[model samples]
Target: MSEQQGRQRVDVTLSINGKSYTRHVEPRRLLADFIRHDVGMKATHIGCEHGVCGVCTVRIDGRTARSCLHFAVALQGHEIETVEGLSADGRLERLQQAFHEEHALQCGFCTPAVLLTAEEFLAENPSPSDSDIRAALSNNLCRCTGYTNIVKAIARASGREGEAASSGTGDAS
Candidate 1:
């Protein structure tokens, strides 16, 4: 029975990326809006606001999903990971470096979300072919003509050796 200026405040707990977060939120707040505004994570961009653009993609539990498609209220006590959480020890992970080495970004607007989505896809299917990667990312839309490098980036991150060479997390390259 808590209240804010006008909206009721409900307790919400979420594990973002790898950290745990607990906060009070308005029921009507969209997850993307809440993440951007409250969490202060600028990486979660909103493009279509409609599920068309995967700019607001995040990982919930272990799967990639659109943050704009759900409400904060519905995500209470859920595990959510944004692009900001993709890094390890403040250093960009292997897939991220792969993006850089493979030149997977243009304009940089969609890179963060695309990175997270690619991470999820690769974690599930390490040996995904170009077409398989394409199918996995069918829901995401990138107009940068960077998908070629992006796909290569995923492939690079999929291998333990490549991941270590790029990620530097000691996975053994």
Candidate 2:
């Protein structure tokens, strides 16, 4: 534990996006806060504070977990992956590209979480069906697209579907 602003804090070392970060935080500090405020990465969005919304999702030790549900101290020595880490050469990754091509995002609040979740799902199931894609995305909430385009984007990323005929058009619900 360390002293910060006259308050007690615990030191946590987190490996995020292939980088290591050590910060003193309160025991109650959420992993999402640590990643965003302490580590200075903004790709992980905080939504619903509770675990009901997957907006705070990140890959912990290669598995998708809600950052809002875990304490910063609990993530010590664990690897975390945010949407910012998914790309190489600063260009959007294939999954992100698919989301763009399929017009999977609107308002853009839930894109990062959905992208992270889709990355994990594709890694585990490279050839998922449309139903499988829908099942995987069920945890993340997107008020804009009604999930049809999101499912199609995942399907395209997984090689289960072809390129979308058009872009930015809302899909059939």
RMSD of each: 7.5, 4.0
- lDDT (CA) for every model shown? 0.73, 0.81
Give per-candidate clash totals: 1, 0
As a TM-score, model 1 comes out at: 0.79
- lDDT (tens digit, per residue) of candidate 1 on 36-130: 88778888999999988889998887778899999887876688888777675644477777778777778888887878777777767878766
- Looking at model 2, residue 33 earns an lDDT score of 97
State the lDDT of candidate 2 residue by residue for 1-173, as single tens digits. 33564487778898998888989888889999999999889888898999987899898988889999999898887888888887745534778788888888889988988888888888898887666777787899888877878887888877767333344333332
How many Å off is the CA of 12 in candidate 1?
3.5
Report the Cα lDDT for residue 137, model 2.
79
Candidate 1 pairs with clashing backbones: 17-81
Name the lDDT value of residue 127 in candidate 1.
83
Model 2: CA > 4 A from native: 1-6, 89-92, 162-173
